[model samples]
Target: MKNVSDEELMILVSNGNLDMMSILFDRYHVRIYNFLLKMTRDQDVSQDITQEVFYKVLKYRTSYKKGKFSSWIYTIARNVFSDHYQKQKNKDQRLNDIHYKTIGQETNSVDDEEIKEQLHLALMKLSHSDRELIIMNRYQGIKYQEIAEIMDSTEGAVKTKVHRAIHKLKEYYLQKI
Candidate 1:
């Protein structure tokens, strides 16, 4: 099962091999959670949105196409986040309350922690789309081609967007410093 590609697992799940869904979940759940966490900056909301993403995969399993499964799953996750954002917008909820949690390392220095927190705040100050673009490219290490596919844009356009997003993030980070 570990040797099976994500696309194959998705196809099997789509074909009624329900157990394959778990495999897909195991493969992508953390990445999806981290993606959502960076976007929403809320642990609980990220968890809920991650669950919704998988539920959507199950609900729309039959619609799976033969392509990069990462792109397809990311597309679904993007849609889920958009829907959640819209609802929050209608409710007048603030989306900028990003509390940055250290994801993988323990910082030993106070200055380092402060710098990380400031950087996180700067990232949160970016527009939602820009923040997502940076997170997907920089943090999650998704390819430009796959991001373009999920975004329904040309690879060149995705590259340009990512470049601009990085520039904007840099400006913001510099301003904070």
Candidate 2:
């Protein structure tokens, strides 16, 4: 499992290698949880959905038949989140549910932290779709092609949407609200 690709591991899982699923879970659970946390701004809900994502992965293991394993898993996570969001439209949220840092940076400066906090606020200002694009593209480091795969769109379209989302984020950040 350590040397195997995600696709191979998932294929093994699909073929009754249930134990191998743990390796996949170990690799992905944090990422899936973080993704959901960013979307929901609720730790408890994110944890619940992250668990459900893995549960669905095992339950629908037979349905996974190829292409990028990461993409498939993200698709499932996104769908699960959508279902949950639809069911619980009035999910509780704090005014500040997240603190964001710049990509690969430790902000020790007060100025930097302030900027990052403002960026987080700006991020919250965007529509859910735009914010999702930013999170997947920038925060999670998911490439446009893979996002396109998870989003069921073309790479070019994903790139354009992400660009627009970034533009919107910039606009909101400039507002400094």
Candidate 3:
């Protein structure tokens, strides 16, 4: 019942420990779902992708690598999103935006809401790659190197993308006001 490292749990699962696999899913499912939810901006699509992520995990359990399981799961989610988006052939410029500000604020704050909306609008204005970079780095707190792995790019490239995306985000907010 003690806390186990992701690598250790993955090993157990690979050794055919079904219970351990369930525990692993329990530990990561919500985190992955939240990440996908934010990225997809559609609860239904997020839910479907969430299930697909787990399915991929289960299918690829034997191929699990060392380092970080988070990065591995994230990679699966990213691929799923890419494939889904491609199949849908969505060409809309608008990206889904979520209300995330005042996350813990108890009182209703109209000003905060407006600012949050503005931020969401700005995020919607970003390209999908920029949006994913910001979300993974800023929101999910994934390391740049790990993001690079999931994204199949260099850490330097990821860092540059984040920097440029932040600059654009600043420009967006400035323009909105």
Candidate 4:
């Protein structure tokens, strides 16, 4: 039900109330998709990964414990992204080579669109873990405590990481400008 909490819904799902899974999906699919899209920068890949994340949630339903559902789902999403990244490292390298070839020839304009584009490009240039921190804390609006739970680290550590990631993103964005 829409009035029930996410953890309660997941508990119901874990108890074999399969229809509750749809409610969970409807609640989170867009957020998860956007998170993946920000990380992958590929629409098709993000869609596939988003589907895979839900599939994983269903598959592991029995393992669901009484906790914050958001944290559990994000942990699953992060793992899925990491697995995809590992498997596609070589292909990514080739794509990066092609991307770099074209990047040099692009004009360094300072229009509104150009600034937004440069910010996006700078985000993409960040290390995967750093980018994840920024995407989670800045873009996705996840609290540091929830991020720490998902990352299996202390809240203090998450705060520090997010701070450093934002600093790096700003430096890179300024360089692009």
Candidate 5:
């Protein structure tokens, strides 16, 4: 099963081989969790949403169409976040008490740590759409083509948005310096 591709595993799951979903879960849960964490800035919420993502995948297994599994999973994650965001729209969603330490690589130098902190702060300051773009493109290292597929946009459009988002992030990050 370890040698199986995500799409193949998902196909198996869709056909009632539910156990194959476990392999897909193991492969994507952390990336999905971290992606949610960046979006929500709440570890607990991220954790809950991550679980929901997998649950939705299982629940909607029959809909799997042998497409890029990563793209399908990201689309599910995006929809879950959107649903959660709509419910929480009335409340203050500003980021506070986000921990970059555990999520980020360990750095010995105080300067590096401070820089990372400032970057995260800057990230938190961007509009959610812009922040999402940066997180998908930069932090997650997702290719522009894949991002476009997940976002339901053209690759050129995603590239432009990512470029603009990075520019905005740079401005905000520099302000913190």
Candidate 6:
């Protein structure tokens, strides 16, 4: 069979073709997990959020609209992250602790890893919207137009938000240093 686009796979999934789900999952799972991992900085939370994103995708497939499928999934991922953060008021502090330990274990050079740790800390200091804009633009490589669609804002607004987010991140890095 020919490969289906993510939108096509979602349409298939909505039509009750259960087999299409795995294809959709395969296409997006790694990126979603990695995005969540970068946001939450917890492997387990990333796993849970990734699972939730798919579950929401499957459960709400009937409601899928046309446009960029990745944006739809990204909107879902953002909701999942927000819900998780709401449940744990100290989420950043928890992730901060885990972030250092993870860098220590994963990187060969302590200095490079420490810089990563510092960056992670800087990211944590950013506002939620600022962090999300960076994630959508930088990590996910989402186009500003698509991000505007997902965010329900104008493309110009998305551009401004991303620019402001970058400025905030810079301030965060400066403060950390």
Predicted structure with the largest TM-score when compared to the true one:
1
The number of the candidate with the highest lDDT is: 1
Q: Lowest-lDDT window of 10 residues in candidate 4?
A: 94-103
Candidate 5: deviation at residue 95, Å?
Answer: 5.1
Cα lDDT for residue 151, candidate 3: 86
Clashing pairs in 1: none
Q: List ranges where model 5 is wrong by over 4 Å.
A: 92-106
Clash count, one per candidate: 0, 0, 0, 0, 0, 0
Residue-wise C-alpha lDDT for candidate 2, range 72-170, written one tens digit per residue:
999999999888876665565333343323345576798977987788778888987898899998989999999999999999999999999999999
Where model 1 places Cα greater than 4 Å from the true spot, the runs are 97-106
TM-score per candidate, in order? 0.93, 0.86, 0.85, 0.89, 0.89, 0.88
Pitting candidate 3 against candidate 5, the one with the higher lDDT is 5
**In angstroms, how far off is 67's CA in candidate 6?**
3.0
* lDDT (Cα, tens digit) per residue for candidate 1, span 1-177: 899999999999999999999989999999999999888877888999999999999999999988899999999999999999989888887686434455666878989988878888788878888899999999999999989999999999999999998888888889988
**Poorest stretch of ten by lDDT in candidate 6:** 95-104
- How far residue 140's Cα lies from its native spot in candidate 1, in Å, is 0.1
Task: Candidate 2: give its CA RMSD in angstroms.
Answer: 3.6
- Cα lDDT, all candidates: 0.90, 0.87, 0.81, 0.88, 0.88, 0.82
Give the per-residue lDDT digits (tens) of candidate 5, residues 5-102: 99999999999999888889899999999899888867788999999999999999999889999999999999999888876664754344434335
